[model samples]
Target: MTSVDLHLEEQSMVVEEDEFREGEVPKRKNKKKRSHADLGEDAEKRGICYLSRIPPHMNPSHIRQILSRFGDIHRIYLVPEDPNIQVHREQASGFRGKEFSEGWVEFSKRSVAKRVANLLNGEQIGGKKRSSFYYDIWNIKYLRKFKWDDLTSEIANKNRIREQKLNMEISAAKRERDFYLSKVEQSRALNFMQERRKKKQKTVGAESDGTEEPKVIRQFPQNRPVADGGAQTKTKLSKDILAGVFGGGS
Candidate 1:
């Protein structure tokens, strides 16, 4: 082919390649756009409800099964009773099971959460006559504008504070133990030195020509009695009379 025709063919091939690339770009963009729209739909508004008091021995699974009757439950969190209280109760009653103090439930929709809280609050949990929780009452409330993240943050903060307090108590106990041990060591050292001094004194006494040295007894001075003023005056008068007679004779 001539040079002009060859150059024209090359330009047409380049144009076709560019058109193909533009078509693929729009397809990828469409896919990304659709993915974003699907995400927006999945992130529906969720709501949380608070249970001030959970029935005794009710676990998270039990709570979900009961509350799920009203709406779709997304999540459930039940706070177990304090370990110390649980241990005491178990020992007294001979009943061993997990008990929950409080709880939070998240529903798929806000309206469902609100309706469940309204209907169940202060109502009796009616079930089979033989069921344990049949007579238990509900103490639930719908928490407005509350989020699961907020609850998680609050729990984390409490745990942090508790750990810090425990660390402080342990360190204080260790310090007290160390101080007591040091004092005991000091007393032992003092006793050891006193015993050594006694032994040394005995050894020195024994080495003195096989005869024990005489120990100097310590004597406290006795207080003298004071004479009355009349006695002192009589003695002075007698002494003056004797001196006058002797001087007159001389």
Candidate 2:
């Protein structure tokens, strides 16, 4: 809802008669009636002009006040670049969306519209002295043969398609990334299991190896007490005694 002004292009002018007819009072001036074909031709003569880099704060009223001085304007449509975007309702920035990149100004007459286009193109809106819109800044370009609806529709479609393409690409990249990460995790788990199996096998082989020898136990005979001459002779429990008994002990 840009600040809108329903300014009519055609204003009624009443011309009074200077001389009076004898015995006749002055009557209201008769207006000429236009045919249906003539009205159609007039509609056709309404040309559209495009403005770029329009200041966000410049509304329909401001523009009409400035450009109507140039010609009679049927209507002016301020086209926002991003239609889906909405300025906060709580704020006053709706009409001042700097995001609006361009707009369309419709003049009631083709010749005047063309005249404005030629005169204003390349010149800054506020550059010249004594201009009504002294602080306004933008450029004017006449779209020779394009209608507003067609151009706006084409741009909107393109933007929508481009956004969809970008979304698809992002989604694809995420999927690919997730897939690669899963593969890496699986590989790590597999490697860990393989290492554990190899360690267990190494331990079993070490235990089964015959590098260590079996332990041996040695026993000695007990000594018996002897009565000096004839009772019993005492046997010694020593390395020497064992060697005499068994020939040699190792």
Candidate 3:
């Protein structure tokens, strides 16, 4: 096919003289370039292809060997149906291993893909169709308007954005919870300290009230008269002082 037929856009191409008005300068026209991937996607939109119940041993080489007889294959992809699944060897010696998967095969011609599906769907891979042992068959279906990478990437991006938002919300909630818990702890500590101080004050007040005694005021004579060698006259004894000393009645 010619380069024009391939529809490969140039990043910048000079405009033809006819594209411009007469006597005008031929200006460059910048065009959105198409990559090989874009071309492949555009071509893939024309075909139909899908395979089911693909065995683990089935690879691209196997598909080429099997389907190339039918037509030219544009692309072949055999992917695991579940990543967590393990294809284990059989416990019995010499027994084979098998794992199930799905696949897609695009053909260069749309008609070839449709014909292949019609001929191969429900066909046994291991034996003649006349035998009962040929029960292990493959299922094939035609896919329409399916772009593998675009759909998968779109889904992955959406999941990534959703996970990020959820993580952010969880982090914010945790911070809020921690903040309130700290406030509650501080309030509890403050209340405990206040109660302790009040109890101490009450204990101190009770002890002081119970142990206190009243003070007594007493009168004493600063000057004293001598008795015998420094004897004092009997009339000199103070009447109020004598009453107190002898427990005399008033």
List model 1 lDDT by residue over 125-195, tens digit each.
88666778889998999999887667777776777897899999999999999999999999999999999
lDDT of 2 at 32: 92
Question: What's the C-alpha lDDT at position 224 in model 3?
Answer: 67
Residue-wise C-alpha lDDT for candidate 3, range 48-154, written one tens digit per residue:
47887675455454565567688866556554444235423444343354344766776777788788888888887653456433556768887665654543465
Candidate lDDT (C-alpha), each: 0.76, 0.66, 0.63
Per-residue accuracy of model 2 over 1-250 as CA lDDT, tens digit each: 1112221111111101211322324446449988999977777778888887666455565566578788877656555555445445215544544445566787878888899989977766773456544666558878776554454466567668978998999999999999999999999999999999999999989977976677799999987755586445555488888798899966
Best by lDDT: 1
Lowest lDDT block of 10, candidate 2 = 10-19
Task: Tell me the TM-score of model 3.
Answer: 0.40
Tell me the TM-score of model 1.
Answer: 0.62
Clashes of 2: 0
- Model 3 segments beyond 4 Å from truth? 1-46, 87-100, 127-135, 147-250
What is the alpha-carbon lDDT of model 1 when measured against the actual structure?
Answer: 0.76
Q: After superposition, how far is residue 109 of candidate 1 from its true place, in Å?
A: 1.1
Query: Model 2 off-target regions past 4 Å?
Result: 1-43, 55-65, 71-97, 127-137, 187-250
Output the TM-score of candidate 2.
0.45
On TM-score, the leading prediction is 1
